[model samples]
Target: MNRKRSRGKNPWRCSHRYPLRRRRRATPGRSRGDPAVDPEDPEQDPDDGNAPPSDDDEDDDEAGPVVTTTHRRFDYPPPVPRMPRETLEMLHYDQFWITYVGTRYRHPALPDDWDMTVEISIPDEFGSRQNIHVRHAPTRRNSHEAAISDAAREALTTLCHAHREDMAITSRRYYPCRSVERLDAWIANPEAEQNPRLESTIEYLATLNTDYNAALDELDMVRYENRKLRAWVAHGVEPAEEEPVEDPADAPRRKKARYNDPEARTYIRHHED
Candidate 1:
């Protein structure tokens, strides 16, 4: 009975060995007689093949040159007008007052009202001396304003007088010719040419070289003497007899230099003897 048994087939084994096939992808417009595309082709377009490329897809060319623009307007305010030459000279002299007296008297909080005065003197080559007075007004408010104001007014009046005197000195140094003919004659004179230093001095005086004069006059008598001494030394000239140098050995030696000794004087006398 076993030999005659019919061959039996395993349906589960056959189904496991042969799995179900996947469905093929459908091509667009293929059914309407359009050409079908090969899915694996490199030149294929994804979107109906008619749309233009987007910015992200476009290739970048070389970078363009940079351009710049500029404006020429001024950034600061205009400069203030400068005072006239005469006014400037006056101001310069007045500035001295501000420097010396004003700084000393000016209030710490508000220094606008600080009264100041400065006197300046200058001597020319011709042995004439000129005096200049300078004054400044107080720009601040204080308890002593009235007194300061009175003093400032007086100083200003004195300054005016001094200025006039300075002008006179300048004028006297270089007297203007009465006529052009006279000026020409003076210029043509051989003596004038020969004395160039005097001519130059006169020219400087006529121009009222206030700054130069002031600078030269800044030296006091002591400074002048010192300068003269230095010049003489440079030229190998000896100083006058009035100026003396003490010999080291001859200088008086100290004798009983006690501060509070009652007999210090007597002791000193005995030491000298």
Candidate 2:
């Protein structure tokens, strides 16, 4: 009877109203089935609408047009190998005597007299073709001759022993036929001076000779400059100004005056007819 119940109105109602209803969340198994309603789809985002498609999406979209990117790897070749060093061959030679001509003197420090003319062929480890010459003659007294003699004797003994050993070893070892033949020839014919090993040894020694000559040339140049500088300092004169003078006859002569008489030129008078 509150104002006559309408046919469509309900009799029961709440005094305070509840909040607005929220949309039902999508279930784990159920979907809205509408493509436009699917919020998980990337196309639904307005910012991503115009963005470029990812590789995965592009691959999924096309079936025939396969996009493949090829990467090329480069490899560098290894460096070249170096050649090995050659092994040295041993050699033997017969004993030969040599004469030396020089002075002999004795030092106060020496127990015995020293001789400079002692000639001995010492064996070299490098080869038998090489020879070393030693000369010892002290000009002053109280020289270290004893010590030098001891050292020289020890060196000579060692050299001789080593030479014998090397010869024995070489005899047991292999040697080039040509080289041996040349050695035999040299031993047989003393005057026919030709060495088979000479060519190779000379080639090797040429490099050393070139270096030695270069050093000598440099030393000579330095010595010449030093001498020139010393001479200049001693004389207290510049080298550039020391020019030779010409002879008196070759020098230019000055003009001479011509006189009619000897007494007339002694006095010069004013002109009077």
Candidate 3:
């Protein structure tokens, strides 16, 4: 038999007197032996009544190192490179030197009018450079590039034909006569305008020509002179002295001609007698 219900102030016996609530358990974060923090204390947080005291060093050791990131725009593109308004460069010591010119770095100083995109310089024996000014007009197709190309084509065609005789005498090891003849044929036929291959050929042929070649020639000449000087020094060779000419006025006067004067001739004859 169940024990008689004891009418005491126990929630188990008298369910109506007490409101239902979850029972509090021992907190894992704190032990029963630990001292409870006073809410009125300044150092302790009022809301965190059950928080346990932790060591600063232990917390720091468990935490990872602090990392600061400095962001950059590697994905973002950079600004366009600066180009020259005008460039003075030498063209063509070799064949197709005209093709060295390109449409890049073109400065449209006058976007609306004509522009001298670039100039070519050819150095002479006197250390003076002859400049060929190339002018072009911007068009609907590609602005100044095509015009510059056409201008170059016109000038280079003329120069090539004029220098054909010069080219025959020089050793054109890379650029053969057949290639020039073919190019000449294309230019003469006016079919080069329709053919992109001709333009490409111009570019291809242009690879062999550069200002460096001219510089190399000059460098070779300097080295040759230096070699001669070094050879002379090593051999102790001295230049031969030129013979000094005798002054005509310093020479003794020739003896008077006896034939020129009758008195001199008679004097000579008497002396003989």
Specify the poorest-scoring 10-residue window by lDDT in model 3.
80-89
Candidate 3, 79: how far from true, in Å? 27
Ranking the candidates on TM-score from highest down gives 3, 2, 1
After superposition, which runs of candidate 3 have C-alpha atoms over 4 Å from their true positions? 1-111, 125-128, 132-142, 166-273
Of the candidates numbered 1 and 2, which has the greater TM-score value? 2
lDDT of 2 by residue, 1-273 (tens): 365443443322111211111233454653332111222356654332222223443222111122221110111011100000001123323432222222222211212222222123334577442224232222111223332332232223223233433433433211111111111100111122266575444444434433432343354355446434633544433223212424321111111222232321211112211
Per-residue lDDT tens digits of candidate 3, residues 91-167?
23531111112222111111211121223334456854444423221111122334344334333333334444543
Cand. 3 Cα-lDDT: 0.27
Name the lDDT value of residue 172 in candidate 2.
20
What lDDT does candidate 2 reach at residue 239? Answer: 24
lDDT of 1 by residue, 150-193 (tens): 22332433333334335333322122211111111011112334
True-vs-predicted CA distance for residue 42, candidate 3, Å: 72
Ranking by lDDT: 3, 1, 2
What is the TM-score of each predicted model, taking all chains together? 0.16, 0.17, 0.21
Report the alpha-carbon TM-score of model 2 versus the true structure: 0.17
Q: Please list all clashing residue pairs in model 1, or write none if there are none.
A: 112-139, 112-140, 113-138, 113-139, 113-140, 114-138
